[model samples]
Target: MASNRPAPESPYTTAVFSEDGAERSVGEWNPTAETVRPVRGRHRHRVMKQRGGFARSSTVLGVGVIAAVGAGGIATAQNKPAIAISLPDVDSLPGVGAFMSEDAADGAEADRERTAEYETMGLAAQEAQPTAAEALRSRILEQAEDQQAGAAEAARAAAERDAAEKAAAAAEKAEKEAEAKAEAEREAERKAKEKAKAEAKERAEQKAKEKAAAEAEAKRAAQLAGSYALPTSSYTITATYGQSGSMWSSGQHTGLDFAAPAGTPVKAVGGGTVKSAGWSGSYGYRIVLQLSDGTEVSYAHLSSMTVGAGQQVSTGETIGRVGSTGNSSGDHLHLEVMTPGGSAMDPMAWLRSKNLNP
Candidate 1:
């Protein structure tokens, strides 16, 4: 038979057992049935309370048990906290350490990348410069502008010089032309004056020649008018040829004398040629006449003879005028007739043939 007794409490769960190979509870044990009891505490306590009639141990023994429990709690606290330290869940603590180390390396690599980027930017700034293309374009444009200005100035100066030269040439040409024209006009005027002078000289010479011819004709007409006039009406024969006289260049009278008035007109006894008619010695203003038949007549002692030698006379024309001249005793005409050889002849007889008595 089994007495109904309470089963002891087990200090360890593994120490508890069941009949069917399954874990059982503390109440399953019975003393009267001879079932074993589970022990309560593995550590002993000296200072303990009496359960039925057993004596409790000393306090010192209880203190030894408490000391052992306290040692175990300290050892557990050293191992880990009761709550366990929170971290990334992993199989190995060394692997966690390695992960942290890898994170540090990544941060270092990022720093290095940032530093390199900054250095590269600095290098690019140093290498950069202005573009040659833009600078060259600026220089070329400036030079081109300067050249254009220079060329324009040169062109203007050249134009002005050319215009001045053209003007000078034109002026010179005009001056030369004017001089030529003036010279031509002067030459023309000089030739005209010379021609006029020559024409005037020719007209003057013609007038002089005509005037000389007219004077010669007038003299001839006057001689012809005097030739036909009659002699004086009467006269006295004072001296005869071959008669002796006191006033004579010859030993005797060589001519007859007809006494008349001082200004009586002398006439020709017959038609004859006046061989000599002018002044002579001992017979002033005398005239000598020659007949066609070779008879000679002498008339002297006259105031003047109207006819010259080589002049023809008519019958009874005045030969001379009676005057007292050149050894004449009185105013009278001396007349005589002679042969061809100058021998004196009687003039009274020659006068009777013309119906005139001397």
Candidate 2:
């Protein structure tokens, strides 16, 4: 049975435990109090040394526990205080006494309460802050997104630049092709014009040659006309050579006669020198011309003689005027041809040989 009486105050009180684990205090005689002197020497020194060692060890253990909590090594229990650890009673050992009292128990309880509150606050702070792994992952994701956006922009710009370059090249090619086509067209036109000019020149040269040939032919014909001419113009043959007629001095007509009006001009039959020009017995006026071939041509019936003896005359030159001056009944010209020996021949035949029509 335990007594309920209050224990007496004693500085040397020691703690003892019963079989039931109940605590009790035992009192002892205090000789130091009876002596009435201050405590000194080794006894005080031993007690103070023991107290300092205990305080230092306890402070180190507390700091270690706080550091563990801050480093996230311990899970703080929020709903309870820490379990109290009681020191062993050492009253039976020499120079040792009760290590814990009622006051010490109270202080231990307060310390436990404070430790619980601190743990609770530390856990709350841990919950409020982000973890290291979570922060690192967020930073990595943000950087990756930024890099991806930058790469996409660079690719878009490259594509646009390539497209623009290709478009410019295509336009340049088209321009070159157009210029080449225009040049070819101009060349073809130039060739066509050159061909046309050549053809026109050829045609003009051909026409000039034709005109020159025609003029040359006309000039030759005029030269031929200058070399020959008709003996007389507008005359009619009245009597032929060797014709039977009664108005002849001979038995037959032996000369040609041209009937014309009076005063008709008579031209030289060919180029010659005049041999005679005078009036005769039965002829009113007469003229004779000797040719270069020694042939004599006589005009027996003429009204007047314009040429004198030994005068030079050309073919178709006026040598006498026509009239019936010899033994003729009307105005007519009797033309006779004679050899160099003075033999009579047909004058019409002689005129035909000279390329002339009588």
Candidate 3:
């Protein structure tokens, strides 16, 4: 809307309009009249900064200059709507209006107003955006979460590795223990086997010793049963058994006599022990042999006794030498046989029974 007011008289004049109201005056501005739209507030520089009004003004001015130049040469004599431009206290310039049509001029004014409105809306939209601090804080929180996640992953991996190592160590220890136990068992078994074998061998040795002793005893008994020997090597019968003579202690001769050289070896009749060997009253130095079966034989008138009391003699083993020393007429051995009861027996019969010709 346009207004009219009566002013005091001065040399300066302001914008004026004609009655049809399409033509108006803008002073010493671009021919498009767009410069006037920037007069929005007292804080004009601040408003221009917020809205980017200067940049829009420059773009609009450039387009206006180009359009005016193109239309300048084509200005026909046609009567277009009038647009007036002026300086203060000066008359309006109508010549500049010849280059642009009324429609173009009006469209330029509308575009300028729409552009300002659009710039205002753009500023409001910019104010609605998030501030820089809020964006920075969100980025920082996101980065912190990423770092925490990475640390958790690393810790989990470390824990898993530790558990694996422990498990492996436990398994190895168990295996070693098992091996040691098995080795101990094997050693015990080997020792047991060795002990048993040693015991068996010892038992076998003892049995062998007992068997050998029994066999030796049997052989000794056999030899004693089959073997007997004459008392001297060579001799002649001097006194017959049962002969009546004062030489006998009994009423008859008590023994048989063999006359032989002095110092003749007297042999045992069988395997026996010498029961006595020494001097007697009438028998001189005598040796009495007791057989294994408890028979006793005596060799009297010995020059020297070869065996001692309790000495063992086999068959044909020398017991004494033949000589006459007491109650003897010459060098002779008086051989006598007796029973276990100390009574004399027939020496001839006894010698004959033992397979002796003497």
Candidate 4:
């Protein structure tokens, strides 16, 4: 009868091998077929023909045990992992598919863990993006403000320089103008001083000329007294020419008088040609003399004569004698000086005219 459920695993049909032992079969079977021998340090697979219960059972058990061991090893390795591992060369083994599968599973687990870590890092980076953007914007704004401040400072400095230059220019111009004004004032003062000095000199010279002319006119208008010589022996005047007298030709004495006894030589007062040297009627033995400037002198009552009419005579030369000649007067000589215009003046006063005051 055919069973409905699968057949139970048979121990006699299962394969069995050893790590360091000889190859052996666990169960008995027909020895009529050829058996393939495993190499040294190797394992073999078994094929199922009619009943596959042994093969299936062994495969299941191998997978379950490997899974459990790998899980336990991963848990233990989290704290203390193996330092060195000696894995069997799977390429040398004929039936190592199960071991290869186990290694692939470990690789898959590591890849899953790495992917989870990267995902966590990405989430953290995404959360910090706004702060980084704000920092960059702040840096840009600060740089812009700094540039604006620098430009403002430069502008202010330029304006200050221009103002300073303008002030300096004004100061220079004012200084020049002040100097020019000072120079002009000095020139004006110098010219004014020169003009004042010139005017003073001119006034001084004009005053000197006027004073000299006035003094000359004063000398010209002065009165004169008659000139005479000492022409007698012990003869002295009893009265002057202007004295009031009893022997009068006028109310005053008309002529000078010399009271002498006899003849005395009379001299000419100035050099001239004699106009007359002879006697006259009232003036006895008188001589009339004319000078170079047309003035005449009279000698009255002469004792003798040494010069003739028209005879040239020198000054201080004797011309006649002094005696009582005319009008019963004593011996005398009358000397006179006259202007060309017939004006007579007193000889005594005229002799004092030249500041000699003789």
* RMSD (CA, Å), each prediction: 32.5, 17.8, 16.2, 21.3
Best-fitting candidate, scored by lDDT: 3
- The number of the candidate with the highest TM-score is 3
Task: Write the residue-wise lDDT of candidate 1 on 72-137 in tens digits.
Answer: 444443333223222222213332222223333344355446545644453343232123334565
TM-score of each: 0.35, 0.37, 0.51, 0.33
lDDT (10s digit) by residue, model 3, range 74-191: 3432234423322121012233233233443454466567655654554443343334345766899999999999999999999999999999999999999999999999999999
In order, candidate lDDTs are 0.60, 0.69, 0.72, 0.57
Clashes of 4: 11
Error of 1 at 209 (Å): 5.4
Candidate 4, residues 27-143: lDDT per residue as tens digits? 654321134332223322222211133233333444444444444544443333323323333334433223233333344345445444544444344344445555766898899
Candidate 4 ranges beyond 4 A from true positions: 1-120, 222-358
Relative to the unseen true structure, what is the C-alpha lDDT of residue 163 in candidate 2, on a scale of 0 to 100? 91
Winner of 1 and 3 under lDDT: 3
Clashing pairs in 1: 3-32, 266-318, 266-319, 266-320, 267-317, 267-318, 267-319, 268-317
Q: Residues 25-46, candidate 2: write the lDDT tens digits.
A: 5556343332222334554355
Estimate the overall C-alpha local distance difference test score of candidate 1: 0.60
Sort all candidates by lDDT, best to worst. Answer: 3, 2, 1, 4
Candidate 3 ranges with C-alpha deviation above 4 Å:
1-195, 198-202, 244-252, 259-265, 279-281, 303-313, 320-332
- Sort every candidate by TM-score, greatest first: 3, 2, 1, 4
